[model samples]
Target: MKFKLIATFLLFATCVTAFSQEKQAQKSEKGLIKISIMYPFAEGKTFNMEYYETKHMPMVAGYLGSNLVKYTIEKGLAAGMPNQALPYMAIGTFYVKSLSDYQSAIAPNRDAIRADFANYTNVSPVILVSEVVK
Candidate 1:
């Protein structure tokens, strides 16, 4: 019984150490680029949320890497706010080693992302760029 307790404690300690290392590694990364997307749906038209989830979002995730963080808001929930004109919106953060790294990674694929929007009708998207301040 005593041997089993020691073994369990060792296993728990090993797991905790591994988790701590991962969190530290994430914290050490620098140069984050934030991409905010705002869109509005026209009357009598519905936004294709599935296409964005399965297709466009995955593409953006692939380009932005595993550290990307995304946030989204829907129409009714966003109504009557100051920026209520935008019914749908998404914010994505990309973490990189440097600003040059961010620029180099996104430059070539920029046009492709812009052109892909034509496939979706009734949704007008506006993208804004920002840097992580803190």
Candidate 2:
């Protein structure tokens, strides 16, 4: 009985490892890449609401290797108060075939975006890369 139990446990462990490997393989095959862009609103300056909503979004869409999956702009909960931080922000998520593809898409247009927002004060975008694991 003990031997049988040990054998069963071993089989279960092996199957679990195999299943994990299969899932990893499937994710690799899909070649999905995720990028997040976070922007914090600058103090005493009006955020470029119109340009972001219209121009920036459309420009991102026009990139060859990536697709804009999600875009969100939210007011900072900590808005104006004494010693309080700024209160407006935006976040954008982009999806692409691979990390290399995403890099390639943005490299050529990097200067364009910077120049477009040159007049804007306190415009900062944080970018994050991610892979879906399920």
Candidate 3:
């Protein structure tokens, strides 16, 4: 009887926890947009990784506020083979929860952001956006 009762209680607790988590997810904001920018690599062209990672991104975070959910930066090491030239210099990914919020917050600062590109790299960044499915 004791074993059966403990098993029943454990099952009930597990179900309740799962139900709670599902409800929480449902209540949270739904839209998540991912923006990826790939910067082409060029011989002798420069990218200031230190300034970008330390200064520019923090400025972006200041401007975007709650709209910017997260972001990541990746440096291109090689194209494929060990000796092959790199196809891209860097890649940046930014996640925003709402499109409207992003537009409102970032639109005004677009020129400033563009200008800062010179501080980082000579290559123009190719931008792409994607919506999270789920």
Candidate 4:
């Protein structure tokens, strides 16, 4: 009876480990969908980079939860031409396993997320969704 119990325990552990590894492998194999939110730069336009990075992004990430692989924020420094104005003030990007995951996650929290934009910048955001290929 003790030997049988030990065997059962070992089997269960092995199955759990195998399942975990399979899940990890599948995730690594899949292509990630990238969502880019760009705020174009304009004369006299106001942007609160600190609030966007510190407060707004964190709130949105919470809503994204486990569906979000990761997120990043970029502040534009200068344009390609020397002494020229930047094309965008800032850009925010996030990655997810699939477009479906991002859609489902954003659908429910869309309102709250949009409402929070006022605390950050006045420029309207342009969105781009693409599959990451390397």
Report per-prediction Cα RMSD to one decimal: 6.3, 9.7, 5.8, 10.2
**Per-residue CA lDDT of candidate 3, range 22-125, in tens?**
97765552567877888889888889888888887778777889888888888888889878789888888778888788778889999998898888778788
Kindly list the per-residue Cα lDDT of model 4 for residues 20-118, writing each as its tens digit. Answer: 999886666468888999999999888999999999988888878788888999999999999888999999999887788779988999999999888
In model 4, which runs have C-alpha deviations exceeding 4 angstroms? 1-30
Worst 10 residues of 2 by lDDT: 65-74
The runs of at least 3 residues in candidate 1 whose Cα sits more than 4 Å from the true structure, single-residue gaps closed, are: 1-31, 44-46, 66-76, 81-86, 89-99
Model 2 Cα shift for residue 9 (angstroms): 44
lDDT of 1 by residue, 20-79 (tens): 988775665423565656675446655556676667657756775544544343433455
lDDT of 4 at 108: 92
> What ranking emerges by TM-score with the best candidate at the front?
4, 3, 2, 1
Q: Which stretches of candidate 2 lie above 4 Å from their native place?
A: 1-31, 65-88, 119-121
Which is the better candidate, 3 or 4, if ranked by TM-score? 4
- Report the number of clashing residue pairs per model: 0, 1, 0, 0
Candidate 2 lDDT, 1-134, residue by residue in tens: 99999999999999999999998767664546667676776655555667776777667657743344434444445656877765447666666666776677788998987776654336667777887553
Candidate 3: worst 10 consecutive residues by lDDT? Answer: 23-32
Residue pair clashes in candidate 4: none
**What are the Cα lDDT values of the candidates?**
0.60, 0.66, 0.83, 0.89
Q: Which candidate, 2 or 3, has the higher TM-score?
A: 3
Better of 3 and 4 by lDDT: 4
Cα error of candidate 4 at position 100, Å: 0.7
Best by TM-score: 4
Best by lDDT: 4
